[model samples]
Target chain A: MERTPITVSALNAYLKAKFDADRQLGDILLKAEVSNFKRNSSGHLYFSLKDENSQVSAVMFAGPAASLKFRPKDGDRVLVEGSVAIYVPYGQYQVYVRKMTDVGTGDLWLEYERLKQKLEAEGLFRPERKRPLPGFPKAVGVVTSPTGAAVRDVINIIGRRWPLARIIVYPTSVQGTEAKDSIVRAIAKANADARVDVLIVGRGGGSIEDLWPFNEEAVAYAIRDSKLPVVSAVGHETDFTIADFVADLRAPTPSGAAELVVPDRRALLDQLDVLARKLDYVLAKTLSAARDRLSSVASSYVFRTPERLLEKASVRLAHLDERLDLVRPDRLLADRKANLGHAETRLSSRFMAILAAAGYAYGRCAGRLELVNPLSIMTRGYAVIRKDGRIVRSVDELVQDDHLDVRLSDGSADCRVLAVRKGE
Target chain B: MAQEQELKFEEALKRLETLVRELEQGDLPLETAVAKYNEGLALAKRCHDLLKQAEEVVVKIADGETLQDFPKQRE
Candidate 1:
């Protein structure tokens, strides 16, 4: 018996119905590597799921894809749970993925993420714990692949930005299985070096696997334990590592790390120069202010005419006397005559007292001078004989019978030393 | 010796700044102003000397070498 041919749409619909009827097959889990992924503007994800044996078309609709926490990319190993449905239009069966989780990472990354969350909750990522970069570091230690461009970039940038910085490079493996240990050791070494002001640890960009060392707990702990400030510069701008979170400073690139470690040379010089100029300006302003004050004081009336205040009072008194003389002529004249007689008597008495006081002062001063005067002593029958304008105290001071001038209170006389007397 | 020793650069600078502000206020008498001005001059000289002797060093971890110069050393 010949069987009737069914349309492709009808056949596909029948298969879809059967698949949906089976509860187990309706929600099944499939594990495969993603390939040929495509994303459209509508936000739906389309990709082929493949294994060594076969490949299956997979589609994550816009709604479910929007809910996905992680982006699905090509070459990702994932476990997708979905129901297999037949498309009538395409006459094909495809899996409508409900959920997808990374598998190649083998739960390690997931566990790492969970631990990170726990640590973050404990305030390990607190901003307060982050140290400040040194404004002027004497020495910088870099922990990265010595042969890699990361070291070179750091060196070049640091040199250009601050030539005074002394950079020490510690060679370490930045990637692979042993990278974590190498990084830890290098960081430890840098911390131990007393001369190191700061430590910079990082590597160039790569896939997640290539940058796994920075995510290691050991590396993070080393950074946290370091006494010296640590800077993390790992992978690309988008890539972040545990070390970055634990470090004192996080930079997007190796060169950025160098910039964080040292300040800009030109900027520092400019600042110093600015400060110098400010000091000079302040000094000049201060001196000018002082000079202005001095000039103001010098121009004051008191300094210009010291007797001006007294002169004004004297002129006012003279005007008052003239007005009194005109107001009452005889009375003013009589008062003036009486005042003159009283003033004359007072003046004569004051004059006599002053003269007496002056004579006494003069006598005291003259008596004091006379006691020290050689001529006064000669008045007591002791004559002072001088030779060569000097006193002839002894015969040894002059030649025998030398002509001498004798000084007395009355008069000075020229005489000759007739005899000399020795100590008897 | 420590007592006779000069003040640190930052300490002297702070004192000098305070003195300048005081002088600018014009509160001190002429004698006091002159005295403070002399003190400020001494402090300024101290700061200048400290800056003149200022030295900074940058050490590299790779070769463990120190580069010395003014603040903000480059490669």
Candidate 2:
């Protein structure tokens, strides 16, 4: 029989209604791998759930997605619990995923691995970047549920190990939807205060789901960015969270963190005792060494026999005195007297030669004088007359009556002049 | 003595260690060594006293509402 042709929209609407009405399709569980996962701006997650041979489209609305402990991503093997429905506009059948979980190891574990790989690639888990816990922390800040056993364990352990440190608890929720935000805020508050030298962020042992907040990225970043060194001590020794990898130090338990952050008082006291003893021994050794040096100097030859220096000085002075005697004034004077006597003898000889020369000259002068003498002329029969004690050699000097004296060789005679005569 | 309380355990320990090393080196004059020995003794006593007399841990709740002592459940 011939029937009326229906449009694509009408057929899709009918199939959607039929699927909604079926009880088997209303609540179904499918084990599949997530593929092409995309979270839209409206917070709705859209993906395709696929088996080895088949595939089905899936979508988780914003409300259920908000409650998810882990974010679903492509290639994740998950068990989705939801209803099967058809989109009327697209004419496609898809699963409306209400709850999704990891099939083999739980989706939270897979998510944990995924985040660990991502943060590790970003160098958040580098060993070189990890800081050492303070050896003597004055204050320790704990981020955990204040009412939980973890805080008490930390407080007591720190108290017993090192009672000097002060504990400041940043009370936070350790589980549920609000756990991540609460943990992040507590870390921030501790950092902002800047009073604590080291921080311990952790919770007591619980299921992976209960401990999921510690695995959150916000908490990891908070631990990474904290100025104070952070010690991560979450769950049992076997449970490792992302915060553990990003922290400055990882403790197997809350008590372990406490032990790592502070030094043991008893151990320190014992060490001080050892050092004190060492100081005593060293001081004694140093003093003895100084005394040894001083004694060695004091027993030297110079100090032992100071008179030897003075004796050597006296010998040098005697040698100098002998040298001075060679230049004595008495010896010098005797030499000068001998030289003067030799000079006196030479002077006497020179005086005798000069006297001989003077005698010969006087003899020659006397012979010449005799030749010019009037007495010698008298011997030749010549006479000189003097009138009025003058010699008259010219007849013009005779006067008619003048008294004259005739000078002879031996004597002078007095005569009277009677007449004047002219002679040719 | 109260000022010694303000001294950090690590700082005190470091100074004590240095003093021990200086004494061990053995180059100081006798008088200087004696003085250093006395000072070292004082530091050691201070360190020992501080460690022995440490106060118990003080716990405070950080809820951002009111800062109060966290009551201990047991000693």
Candidate 3:
């Protein structure tokens, strides 16, 4: 058959139409390694999808490319969904990618690991940097989707565990294009409120694509910089995100985060019960011990019968009194009187003896005087004559016809001397 | 006393523990022990009452712009 000549544009247009009409080509899924990946200034992505032995040109426009969870790099293994079509103007066939995903090791996972390593190196994920959850949180802030089961699960669980804590839900988009910004904003808002003691950033279990927002750098940094302690519960237990690494604490599930944030009221009450019993026991023991001590002291000899302490003194005082009676003034005076009377009697007898001796001496002297007495001569009719009160022994002492006083043994007379005479 | 009244449940519990410990140590004078016992009893009662009288859980929703109380789910 003779071929009709066709222009290059027409030929290309025919090939483009053929590619578009084929159902399989319209929606092709291919797993290939990315090569020469370049994001243009217009936000369009240009790359080549290659296998070991084959390669195909691929381009993702700005619309779908804007929604990519990670920046596609050269040599990244990717699973792309797009339609194969010929560009008539370029005269080439290429895949116009609608959606792209990492195949074996997911692109989001790789991004998560890269961020985890980076933040870990920066000590964001250091155990020392991890803040301890408040033992008694006054309020719990949750950053999660408002419509999902995550918030409900968290609320219910927290209610069951510790109802004292007020739940402040910061509603956020958990998935899709705005999920990252929503999550970051929610975390910021929760931190700014300053009312919540701890923050729970979480969502229900989802695929890596659905959970990509939590792996975002912005969300990770938000968690790291949050003033409130953050608890990350992004997905299933096996799913780890960068936010989990950067957060102060990580729980496997949203319910787990709730459980971790607050303590069970019943358990605390039980602990309190134990403590109350201990308090009672301690107080009772102290009281009884104090009472026993008091009683023991009260029953001691010094306190029980205080008068016994004075009993010895009283006996001593009585003995002292009896001894004092022996030195009484009346008894002393009576003894002194007896002694004086005896002395007086002795003195009187001595005086009487002395008087008798004196009387005898006087009588002896009288007798002797009688033996040679002139007064006795007077008694025998001889009288003593005295002129001028002296005996007239000398006649010269008298004068005749002179007046004289005369003293005799019995009488005295006054006379005048008449003449003087010598006596022999 | 105002501070005691403002004591958090955890703080109250901690104080009660310390009081019990002091009582158990057993050297305080009778008057001081009695006073401590009273304080401990008060703290215990406070903790108990706080736990027992806790209000139910409350949920609030951020309605894309402002936070409001989440509607209670119908049983």
Candidate 4:
């Protein structure tokens, strides 16, 4: 039997050549659980991959990491598709993963989804609990890592959108076991401070494990209970976490969260301008319409017939005047005065004439009475005498004459005569 | 009385809207329509003035954890 020594360089070169030649070895699929994963400054990933029986080292460069849709972490069961190669410096075989996918979505992912669903069922993701972002937030509170690209993005976006907003940075652990507690405390502090109007809770994009604290139940509960409205901006646009569900609002990125919290001054002004113009148009149209209506009413028949309305009253007044004319006081008084004057004149003249006639008649009557005076009759008296108290004046009386006496004017004679004489 | 108070921009805008509707309905007396038209004109002016006087504001939040006044963009 004989033994021969080999050169280390020759053996290593041969092994490297073999690795380079086998295309199937360079492009194969390996399924294992992730362990001791760390990202370097140059953006290269280093980690261990293990199965139930064997373990191997793996590396994924920044270029491939960037292309990956899902983040990788410790204990993540992954199906990696890459070529097997030897690291010349270490002289050891390792996998350079090009593409990777989770094995059955991994246990961590299942737990994450379960918690997310449970919280959602409890109404934690309800839109009604969401608060409207302020049109112009006076102050803003931030809960994230003190030093990260997320902080820079938010600051830049907010500064660009609204310069007047006062920013309050609350430093917290963003990617470790203690991160959930720290974030919760910061949110509480910001809420307790009356000065904060809104909050932004987020961090830069990273591996799923790196971003796990934001997905924790405690962190989500804290966000749900915050008095100040919160905008979740944890990870990149495609990444969703529990904080997103519980927050008042969800932004695709940290920069987006800043934009949501503060209003765009220029856009607001532009909107106001448009509204002002609309208001003016509405007013002008209204006024013109009113004016037109007013003109129409002014030309209506009621105003035009005013004189006709007065004509009816004038006719009625003339009728009243005619009725009043017949009973005038002056005319009645003049007629009564004329009647009184005529009666007084007629009465005086008639009485005077009657009185004169009566006086004449009375004088005549007195003259007649004077002619029948007794002295006149006595001057014409004749005397005769009768004898022995008897007087006979006719022969017819002589038959019974017993004694007779006669007397002339200067002699005396007595006679007795008894005779009856009848005269018609 | 609330409608008549056009001292504020929002109130003025509301009055203008009401006036427009009234004019569109075509039922107001001529004198009343004229009065409303004059009031609408005044309200429009008030609203325009309010819009013109408004200024904009910007703010910046850092790391989604810190807040700061946004630096004005250099035109």
DockQ of 1: 0.12
Candidate 3 local lDDT, B8-57, one digit each (tens): 77788888889888988989987898899899888888888887766687
Model 4: share of true interface contacts reproduced: 0.21
lDDT, residue A247, candidate 3: 88
**Candidate 4, residue A24: lDDT:** 88
Q: Which order, best to worst by TM-score?
A: 3, 2, 1, 4
Best by TM-score: 3
lDDT for each residue of candidate 2 in A1-424, tens digit (9 for 90 to 100) = 9999999988998898999999999999999999999999999999999989999999999999988755566777888899999988898889999999866557567788899999999999999989987778878899998888899899888888788778899999999989999989988988887668899999998767778899999888988888989999999897888999999999999989988988888888789989998987887678777778889988987678888768888899898888787577987677678778778877777878788888898899899899898789898888888888877889898878789988788887888888888886
In each prediction, how many residue pairs overlap at the backbone (N, C-alpha, C within less than 3 A)? 27, 1, 15, 38
Which residue ranges in model 1 land beyond 4 Å of their true spot? Answer: A1-74, A79-100, A117-123, A126-128, A304-424, B1-75
C-alpha lDDT (0 to 100) for residue B60 of candidate 3: 74
Query: Model 2, stretches more than 4 Å misplaced?
Result: A1-105, A301-424, B1-8, B28-35
Candidate 3 docking class: acceptable
Error of 4 at A366 (Å): 32
| Residue-wise C-alpha lDDT for candidate 1, range A277-388, written one tens digit per residue | 5545555666777789899998999789978867988899899888876678798788889999999999999999999999999999998998888666767777877888
Interface RMSD after interface superposition, model 1: 7.1
Candidate 4 lDDT, tens digit per residue, A336-362? 667677777777777777777777877
Worst 10 residues of 2 chain A by lDDT: A102-111
